[model samples]
Target: MFLPPRWLQKDSFPEATTFLAAELSDQFLKLLQEVGPQSNEAILVPASQSLALRSQLRTELSRPDDFSPLVLEGMLMTTVAQAGRSLSRRHHGKPPAWLSRAKELLQDFAGAPPSIEEIAHSAGVHPAHLSREFRRQFGCTPGEYGRQIRIQQAKLHLTKTRWPLSQISLQSGFSDQAHFSRTFKRYTGSTPLEYRRSFTSQ
Candidate 1:
């Protein structure tokens, strides 16, 4: 079901297979455009729930009289929403080679991320240019992304181990437990203790 831009004009289906196709209706296309411009080519994301949704869709299609349009539309929209989210995380157009390298460096040094200048040097670009393009492409500054990565690591330790806040903070690149608590709260809308308590209680 991959469709390129203007696919209706360029592609044709055999009569037997026509029933298998679904048009990107104007209403749905408008909804997608509101999120962001639809990519010229479709982007696919491997989601765990997709198989379940597809199975449900098939079951509904088998009994057309019992099928609910609302449920069908929900399934279609969910798949589109997941793809849109994945696309937003990538560059608008084709990504530059350096962008991947820069992301790799960020993950490699998540515990102690490099400075903007250092990252630019590593990626073979000027600092100002890297900052501009990185933000434009990834939708966040490199430092912000690095902080998110650190916080995610800290969250894992918080849930999986009984480590004290101080130790988790140091290990996850925060200056102290207080700083970690504030940052974690800002990002997740829950303090470290609150987050862990919710998970443990569950």
Candidate 2:
């Protein structure tokens, strides 16, 4: 069972038996407000989505102290936003054409992401306007999304290969190993070495 904050009192689930609970910090709540729907009722999550959430929850629980509170907060915010998107899609059909186009632009250029100005030029929009609209559509800036892709690639290399951290860092497009480690830990809540160890130890 999961519950929204006390302020979102319109939601209720009396029949739920198993609970995965967390205290929503102000930052998490703010993120929800930004990306989530303005709904009062509970949303039905599909079994596949629920299973994925359960896996992530278990991973977090297994090493509770390994993550910062901010990283945990981000995880919850992302989960809630995903559920909100599902609800929105069920009600409003698919996303808009412009959003789809923007997503395509982002994905196509993610490996070597263009600057916001360059992206704006490609989209025939002003940089400030593009920045605001992109965040509203995708919940993060284009640069942040590109960094996420790079970090994900780094994680794959860390798990699947015996390459040195410096090599992985360069391949992932970071300036150096230290920058890569800092950014990775900031987003993922674990250092690169620790992430690799978890895989190897298993």
Candidate 3:
């Protein structure tokens, strides 16, 4: 485990919990809940904390005698990785074979992902086979689809909600208010306040 920098704990640790069990990814983050990813200015803890974590882990893992540092480090890394994969699976929450049929069925799917077995049944194939083909077709796992859906939902909330940023974030499936703010600014090039202002006062 990495030790956070003093700055990360400065005043109050705001963005720390959002990443408690999360993975850093390029397109999206697999947060514990249905929380969306954050953007620039979102990570308040500073890069120092991350650097410290790595350095600490590295230093500790360097010890061999009486430490079993290698084994412990390996386990820790593996666990973090597995958690990410698991969260991705859950976020995808899709059954590949059923997706097309679901598309036909749900109609308003709005690009949401289908479950694994669902995709298999819809494709008239087995789950394993369906997973391969679906990845080939989409350039990403079903998890990407769910991210798109959630991102779109966030967009809608930014456009529609008159509530507080945190409330809008929760209602729209983000991990927290700062996460929503960062993502909203990145995706739309505007803060939630600015985006909402664009709408009519209806």
Candidate 4:
């Protein structure tokens, strides 16, 4: 991952009075405000259909990070909202604690597959919020991420053990061999038996 800039020193808070996750966009607003205090600058943006604000934000998400993928994505979106609020003083970013909660929720939820409500509670957000942004940050929804994680674990078991397919499926979180066979083929284009053979033959 790329190193963060000097501007992002997390410890430089209250004492030095830096930005909170909620205030990130606010700080940017301050920057814009300081440029002329009361004058508005013509910020040219390409996303003309939906609020140009969201388009501008999508652009800032290209930055890399030390946070896990989901956390990084939330942080990126937060940064965008901050940029938008800074430019126009719209001020609509999630609370820093909420974003942190979402990260922890992502970690906790993945430890075992979780219900949408369980995940949302862990993250301190509504189920709808969890479902919506979870997909935005990850290409798949939370449930899909869990399913893929389970499937990948199944792959590991299939390659590393001569265990029977039923046992492998059970151990790796599948409901049954039939379910495992379907998922395995979807992921790798081969049956479990064929996958085991490839690994064993090698």
The global C-alpha lDDT for each of the candidates, from Candidate 1 onward, is 0.73, 0.68, 0.50, 0.56
Deviation in Å, model 3, residue 37 alpha carbon: 32
Least well predicted 10-residue stretch by lDDT in candidate 1: 11-20
Local distance difference test, candidate 4: 0.56
Collision pairs in model 2: 1-18, 1-19
Among all windows of 10 consecutive residues in model 2, the one with the lowest summed lDDT is 8-17
lDDT of 2 by residue, 35-59 (tens): 6655354544433355577677777
Candidate 1: residue pairs that collide: none
lDDT of 3: 0.50
Candidate 3 residues 108-148, lDDT tens each? 34333467677567657787866665554433455444554
lDDT of 1 by residue, 125-157 (tens): 999999888766765678877887888898899
- Sorting all predicted structures by lDDT, with the top scorer first, yields 1, 2, 4, 3
* Per-model TM values vs. the true structure: 0.58, 0.55, 0.36, 0.47
lDDT at position 16, candidate 4 = 29
Candidate 1 stretches greater than 4 Å from native: 1-94
On a 0 to 100 scale, what is the lDDT of residue 159 in model 3? 69
Q: How much does candidate 3 score in TM-score?
A: 0.36
Q: Which numbered prediction scores highest in TM-score against the true structure?
A: 1
